[model samples]
Target: MKKLDVTYSANIGSYLGVPIILEDNTMFGTLCAIDPSPHKFDKKDLELMQTLANFIANAIELGQAYEIILAEEQRVKKELELAKKVQTSVLSEPVQLEKINIQAYYQSSESLSGDMYSWFEISPNKFGVILIDVMGHGVSAALISMSIRSLLKGLITSISEPIEVIKELNHHIFSLFNSTHQSTYATAVYMVIDTELKTIEYVNAGHPSGLLFLDQKTMKRMDEGSIILGIFPNLKVDKQLIHYNEPSTIMLYTDGLTELINPVINDAIHTVENIIIGEPDNLQLIEEIKKEFVNGKTLKDDICLITVNVE
Candidate 1:
């Protein structure tokens, strides 16, 4: 009572206060009660006051934590948007050449996709087409994919051959992200089309089988896929080479499309083959796929497809 250091304590004959501390041992503020008349506080009264302070501290902490979480959510949303933009930029448009008309369709279950398809004009008469699906989805797979995307043009141009391109890809995965978890890898289909040679040379690394329409009635399943990329130091890859007997439409896709159509991969492939056989033209096939899968259904994974027409 005699202490002049107490600010605004002149009218208050009694005062009780306790500091509020968070669970992390950080001090927040003071909890206090003041009265004009002096009153003695018992152990129970002090305990109750402390208990109230603890409740307030917990409430404040909860509010703070909620705010932090909201801020983090907004930050992640913005980052994913930016990443989607960057990812979209790298994806090449369909290569509409004189002898070949290549078209691609891509959709992500999330803002960012692990599925990607692109083609590079390796030479005047030849172009390289690739479609890949990383092991899982989201940020980690996306990062790995972008890293691989950066290397695609050079690798496809210099290597040229499908077998060597995939082997070098495996080597890169092993060398670059060997630090990642064991399951970090991607299934891919790399193809080199020579319009002049009239041959399609391709390598499938644990991806879905590509569909090739030989004629209106006949279809060939390109299922000679080896193990996935990012596995094994020494890899043996046999490139499959096929000469188009006539004007043919070749479809390369990730597993996401098949997985959506039917749980069984082979059955889904069969369904897709039937659909493509019904409408073999590039635009018609893409339209059919949209009507069946992308019309109203919500996808569970990334879907990417590439179509090449040899005329």
Candidate 2:
């Protein structure tokens, strides 16, 4: 203090003080006591003063740490809220086309999700559909999914071929997320449905095999495709074509739905086929499947389901 200068020392007869220092050796302030008359402080007096100073330093440090934690928590909460809003906006609603009905259901975990799904009508009876699941959760994964989302309509409409569209998407993903130390990737399935031709050309890139239901039974399993996107410099894509003369439904989903029933995706596809068998209405089928999913177990990850019902 300015009052503790040499000029003022003559007025203070006796004084003792200890600097309040934190664990990081940052000096906070001084703990001091002064007497008007001359006096001598003993060892006990000095020890007591030192203890009080230490206590004050610890309290101040703890209070500061608590405030910092609170601030960080608030910042993260706001960011997640913003991310969730952006995520919901990008996710498209279920659409009904000229020859096919497209239905989708999504469930988010505690935080943000990487699961994304959408379908765009290329023409009256032709549509391009896609479902993607990035590797992880939270802001990073959600951002990657959203970035891919922005490219969906353009890629689907322009390319119009499953293999070419997925290959292009893989190139984009690889270019965006490849780092020297780490890389991010996502599993995806892209389909071009031509109701006039009664054909569905699809490519599954390191994703769960899709289920195709016809005549109340599982007819085809979509297992063709290559590795996930964003990992390697080059990606190999295999497109599979299926013909459905009669009315049929195709189920495309992320890994979250499989995690509850079967860790194996093919097995999960078979299990869900049972639910879609009796329900002919695409909308009712979607609701029934959603009910089946939440019946007993809690969802561990984000679940996204897209069903294409060709009429």
Candidate 3:
């Protein structure tokens, strides 16, 4: 008798009613009665065949499931990368103004960031600057920040007052997030400086208080607006007015700069002012501060600084 194992045999036997198998001990075909049918195999033999087929089917199904999971993961990763690039591009670069000198820097903590800063020339002399940080970081936060930027850009040309700019923006953000159960918020500081009048008007919305250096001797912290955007409906922020005459520097920044635990805010501010007082150049001032407090270290949070020298 020849060996007749399912693993070895490529063809089925003509006599299907009998169970044919080869024992491992010897290469001899053995026959056993699987179903009591004289004509052909019965339901019992058919069931055994179906059981084996099911095992192969299960293996194929598992392999397909694993492939689907891998593909979904890869798709999500690609989408995140694209979102990061779009968010970074939406934040404006160092824009040159005709009358005013502008030096600005933005460092994203992650591949995607919530922090956004934009400056646009409303006219030759009149310009608009916005510094904003969404509630969190990553894709969701980056999307919120991008939405805020779009809303601002559309409304900025029509709105002249900083408070009005914030009010309208707050309404748009809150309304958009209300239905989706997506509670998104932002902290922002906006300013419009009139170079001819030498007056700076700003509105702050739950962001870090900005710095106004008056001849290096007098330093005033500006904190005007009350609530964060998207928290309240029809939010109203008071616009604080400051007059900058002579050689004065207005420092608009995010909280990531001051919240450092090691150097501390007081020590950091001292280090920045010491270099900036004598050196009037905007580029030189930021370089000195970055070297001293930041130490060329990679930032954990997004850091944005906009220094405007009133000329």
Candidate 4:
């Protein structure tokens, strides 16, 4: 006390204080009081001051904890936004060729999507298309989708067959999840089109079947495939080929579109089939489907749709 500098005032003569310490043995501040006259505090008075200091320390700790929680929440929110942007930017745009027309629509139940669709030209007349659904929602699923996109982009350059591409993807996903002791799965459909041959070769990995519309009155669904990817390393992917003699529309979609709840459309699949057969153009079909199934209500899962018209 003698070594410390004191500020003498006319009215204040004495001061009493107790250190406010946190649970981690860190000092937050001091609980202090001042008196106008020179005074000596009793043991009871000191005890009371200690109790008040403990209370102040607890309050300070709580405030700090709350700040940390708030910061974490904001960080998560920003990460989700960034994830959404990354996922959206990776989606393929509508492709128009001399003999083929492609259109796609995508929507997520949340800010991040697990569903993804992509298509690119494999050769001068050959094109590769894929649709995938990771078995979850939000950031984790979105990350997996992004990884799948990267893998597909690299694989498509070397592999021209849909079955071999799916096999490689399954092997990669299986190996990754097995090493981490985590179980994650995804359903996918991949198709490769040869314009010169007028044929489509495709493989489905536990996803819903894609429809082949021969005309307004004739249609068929491609339903042959294997189990979901990442379930096992040794998956037998069956590849199917179809030769189209005339112009046809092939539609691929996630289960979210087939499971939508609409009062007017009792069966979502039937509604989609009706639109594909009835609508004259792809844009009208897309707009009509959105109006019927997705305009007003929140989706229960991520929705992805891809239509390829071969002429």
Candidate 5:
């Protein structure tokens, strides 16, 4: 075990003339053969011992490095799974509501997403729908969207007005980010549809303007909300009242749908017109809208579409 210079071989058992390297990087004294006749060991045997020591050192280093990498990978995967659960929970669980027929879609650019949709029946005839897009994508944005969703569900229950809901949600979100200095915000559209009265009430807050498909050849963009949410406090949202005279299709969506850089928004509007132009049916129009967005092409951001069919 001693790491002395080329000296004191006899004291450390050099009977066989075989040299050994200790695990602690120190060379052990040699052990020579026990034959009566004098014999000398070759240089090749010493070289082999040196090579074996190097291999052991390398194996230990590699094993430690591999474990470190695997640990990191598992940590990331667990975080991602948690985020997915949160995102999915933010959506309507059953995906079906009474009186108001809903069709919506969401696509994310990564494992975690920034887009979210929340909807519930306010009454037997009235339904509230909210679609939102946080500033960025992935875990941070998804968590923020989830918070907004929970806050809205609580806020909307007491308040049926879209404008008031946005104003309150904005203040809550702004206060949250101010404490953290995150500077995050969301673009949203809140719509309240009354089937009995046959009207659509909306409060837009810096969202992509929506389009109302009146007939096969006509469609009008509805984009009259105030500033984006989470930016200012007590801001007023523009309210629009859409009167549905007959059984027609109404489209409300996130910016990802129209602005995917595919120029499909215009075509999408035209497509809606083609299907429901002359006389639109509720069931038939929803099928066409789903076929347009869900098939053939993929969306870059979260794409959500909610359609109301007036009976």
Candidate 6:
């Protein structure tokens, strides 16, 4: 060993060092020892030093693994945030027209949701609205929901009929899953409203029945269609028509709204029916409904609601 300034100044006599090498043969540093006076380390001392070096190496490796884990967690969190933003951006905004007023509400149980909805004008006086709920929650379901949203945006442009649109979507989703060998499904309700004719044509694909409030004490349920999408390739869905003779309200929602824990499903539906029967303003009704599922009560799944008031 060279007599460096530090060694000479400190009167170091001997040194023992072992490289802290990882399992991948990457060197982190060195486990070293120095002496201030002339000394000789015996065979036993050398073996003990080697053992300590091994311990140090293991600790260092564990620390590095922990750092890697932390970095991966941060990356996943950021990706989830971005996904949530994209999902929220795709949701439909409230629609206010001369003949109808519509409002929608959505809430994700976690960082990402599987519920989605859209509303657009098909013709000059005709409007199309759709609500979809993927089978599960989280990133996978959110991605499926987004894919369906993109497909529907294109399908609605060409297919004006609700049943046809659902058929096309089901075919596409089923084909995609068949090729990928992954089984996934979604429930949806698609509706088309004609202002001049004062009629609504809709098809429900295994989703919860929509509530049509006829008057203060009267409400009609719309529950006509085939099974859920993505299960079968060639499926036929039936479309139901409602000809409104007077002012009315139509409520479309996901099962999450009525599938709460404290109140049973039937009771929750009754509660919502009561709220719709009493509340006149759609926005106020949404707020009240939200209150029912809040205050330390976590949602079991994503919640979505669409309210359309026909005048």
Q: After superposition, how far is residue 44 of candidate 4 from its true place, in Å?
A: 5.9
Rank candidates, TM-score, best first.
6, 1, 2, 4, 5, 3
Specify the highest-lDDT model's number. Answer: 1
Would you list the C-alpha lDDT of every candidate in the order shown?
A: 0.86, 0.83, 0.72, 0.84, 0.70, 0.85
- Cα error of candidate 2 at position 17, Å: 8.0
lDDT order, best first, reads: 1, 6, 4, 2, 3, 5
Per-residue accuracy of model 6 over 169-204 as CA lDDT, tens digit each: 898778867987888998999999888898999999
Q: TM-scores across all candidates?
A: 0.86, 0.82, 0.71, 0.81, 0.73, 0.87
Most accurate candidate by TM-score: 6
> After best superposition, candidate 6 residue 117: deviation in angstroms?
0.4
- Clashing residue pairs for model 4: none
Model 4 Cα lDDT, one tens digit per residue, 12-107: 566788999999998888888877666778889899999999988888889999999999999999988887888899899898888888899999
Q: Taking the tens digit of each residue's C-alpha lDDT, what string does model 1 give over 15-71?
A: 789899999999999998877776676788789889999999999999999999999
Off by over 4 Å in 3: 1-77, 215-217, 261-275, 278-280, 293-298
True-structure RMSD, every candidate? 3.6, 5.2, 8.6, 4.1, 7.0, 2.9
Cα lDDT of model 2 by residue, 120-182, tens digit: 888877899999999888778888888899999998987788888888888888878565567
On the 0 to 100 scale, the lDDT of residue 73 in model 2 is 96
Task: Report the candidate with higher TM-score, 3 versus 4.
Answer: 4
Regions of candidate 4 where Cα sits further than 4 Å from its true position: 1-18, 32-49, 262-266
- lDDT, model 6, position 152: 75
Cα lDDT of model 3 by residue, 1-311, tens digit: 23358513544443442222222333223233342222466688767765555564555567768999999989988987887777777766664445467787777777788888887766557777888888877777877787788877767767867989998878877887798887778888898877777778889999877777765457777678768988878786799888777767767777677664244766655545556566656777677667765676777777778887766
TM-score (C-alpha) between model 5 and the true structure: 0.73
Who is ahead in TM-score, 4 or 6? 6
